[model samples]
Target: MLRDLSRPIETGMPTYPGDPDVTLAPDATHGADGYATSRFRTGTHAGTHVDAPRHTLPEGEAIDERDVGEFAFDARLVDLRPLEQREAIAPEALPDPGAIDDDVDLLLLRTGWASHWGSDRYRDHPYLTAATAERCRAADVGVGLDAFGPDPTPTARGDTESPASDGDEPDGTPAHDVLLGDSLPIVENLCGLDDLPTRFRLYAFPLRLRGGDGSPVRAAAEWDD
Candidate 1:
C-alpha cells in the first residue's frame, strides 16, 4: 500500500515565519479562459519540501545538481510524540541506531505536530538538537520531520534579534548545518507518517529547478503488509 506523506499546500496554509504565505488563487476559469488554472506563489521551501545542501552551505549543491537517487530511499519512521512545545529533541528520543537496517537511508520523526498545521501553535513545535543531527549523520541517514523546521523556535532561544552582522556565524541552525553539510536532504512538513509502518520505501523527488536552494516535494511512502 502507498501512503502520501505530503502536507497539502493551499491558501492560508502554515509557513515558516519568514517564508511567503501560500496563495492558490484561481487565475483562469472555464467560463473566462476555457480552462481552469490557479496561480501558485510561495517559497520553494513551503509545505512538504526538501532542503538541499545549498539551503545552508554557500558552495553546497542545489536541488537539481544532486543525484535523483538521493530523494528515494529505504526509510524508517520513529515516533517522538508528546514532545513538549519548543523542546529540543535529544539523541535518546530516537530508537537505537543499531536497530535500523544498514540500508535505511531516511529517518523520519513523527512529532504529532501536523495536527496543529494551521494554527500559531505549529510554530512552537519540537525540533531536533544538534546532537540528534549528529546521530543521524553518524548513522548515514537523511532526516525528515513533521514540523516547521529542524531547529527550535527562534523565540524560544530568548533572542529576538535578526541575523547577525557580516562575518558573524549565525546561531541556532545547527540541525540544518550538520545534516546539509553532510549532503543529506531533509524533508519537512511531512504528514501521514503516523499511518506508516516502522520500515517503508520513501519517494520524495523535488522540482528540478536549476540552482534552486530547495523545492516543495510530494513525499510518499509504500510498504508491504
Candidate 2:
C-alpha cells in the first residue's frame, strides 16, 4: 500500500511565519500557447519540505549533497495526541531509545495538527522540547512531524484566533540545534500520518536544487498491502 504524506503546494497556501507565500501563475496556456505551463514561486520550506543541516549550520551539507538513499527510511510513527495547542512535548512522550527497532532510521510524531491546516490554529500546533529532540538523536533516528517544526513556531500576539497558552515562548533553535546540528534531516509539514501503519518505509525526496538549504518534497509511505 502507498500513501502520500505530503501537503499540496498551491497559491496562497499558509506558510511558516516570515517565509514567502506561495503563488502559481500561468506563463502559457493550451488556449494561447501550444502547451500548458505555469510559473511556480515559493520558499524552499513552503509546504511539505526537507530541511538539510545547512538550514541552520553554515558549514552543514546542502540538500543535494546528501545521498538520495537518505531520503528513504525505515520509519516508525508515534501518535502523541490529546495534546493542548502549543503544548510542550515531554521527553517521556517518545519511546525509550532501546525500544526502537534496530531497522528504524526515522521517527515520525503525529500530533494531529495537520487537521488544522489553513487555519490560524495551524501556527499554534504543539512542539517538541529540546529535550525530546535530544532523546530522538540519542535513539539514532531522524525526525518528522505533522505540525510546523519540532520546535514551537512562535505565535505572534493577535495572530491567531486565540492567544497562545502561557509559557509559550519560543525555544531558540530547540529541535533544530539538536537534530540538524547533528547533520540529520528534518521533514516538516507532513500530513496523513494517522492513516499510515505503525511501521512503513517513508520516502521524502526533494528537488535536486544546487546548494539548497531545503526543498519541497513529495513525501510518501509504503508498506505491505
Candidate 3:
C-alpha cells in the first residue's frame, strides 16, 4: 500500500511566520470562456518540503545538485511524540541507535505535531537537539520532521536554557549547522508520517530546480506484507 506522507498544499496550510502566505486565485475558468487555471504564490518552504543544505549553509549545494535518486529509500520511524519541551530532542528519547540499520537511508521522527499544525502550537514546536544531531551523524542517517524546523528556537542558543540574546539569536545557526555541515539533508514541515507504518519504503522527490535553494516535495511511503 502507498500512503501520502505530505500535507495538502492549499491556501489554508500552515507556514512559518513571516513566510509568504499560500494563495490560490483563479486566473481563468470555463465560466469565463477560458481554460481552467489558477495562480499560486508562496515560499518554497510553504507546505510539506525539504530544506536543501544551501537553505541553511552558506556555501552548501542546492537541491538540483543533489541527485534525485538520493531521496528514495527504506527508512525507520522513531516516534518522539512523548516529548513536551520546546528545546532539543534529548538523547534518551531516541530508540536504540543500533536498532536503526546502517543501510537505512533516512530517519523519520514521528511527532504528532501535525494535529496542531495550524494553530499556535505549530510555532515553537519541539525539535531535534544538538546532541541528537551528533547521534544522527554517528548513525549516518538523514533526518525528517513533521514540524517547521529542526530547532525549537528561531535563532541560535547561548546557554542550554536561554537564547544568546533574550533567548533568541540574531540568526538561527546551530541546528542548521549540525546537519548541513555534515552534508546530511533534512526534510521538514512534513505531515501524515504518523499514520503510516514505522518501517517502510519512502520516496520523496523535489522539483529539479537547478541551483534552487529548496523546492516543494511530494513525499510518500510504500508498505507491504
Model 3, position 224: C-alpha lDDT score: 92
**Candidate 1: where is the Cα deviation over 4 Å?**
155-170
Error of 1 at 107 (Å): 0.8
Better of 1 and 3 by lDDT: 1
| C-alpha lDDT score of every prediction, in listed order | 0.84, 0.88, 0.75
Error of 2 at 38 (Å): 0.6
2 or 3, which is superior by lDDT?
2
lDDT string, candidate 2, 19-60, tens digits: 998999999999999899999999999899999988888898
Deviation of model 3 at 4, angstroms: 0.6
- Rank order by lDDT, top first? 2, 1, 3
Candidate 2 displacement at residue 201 in angstroms? 0.3
Task: Report the C-alpha lDDT of model 3 over 93-174, residue by residue, as the tens digit.
Answer: 7665687776787788877777767666566567776777777777777788888877764422233442233353224656
| TM values, all candidates | 0.90, 0.96, 0.87
Model 1 lDDT per residue over 1-225, tens place: 988989888998877877788999999999999999999999999999999899988999999998888889798888887887777788988767787789998888889998888766777778787888888888888888898888864432343433222332236689999999999779999988776888889899999999999999998898997
Q: Pick the candidate with the highest TM-score.
A: 2
Off by over 4 Å in 3: 153-171
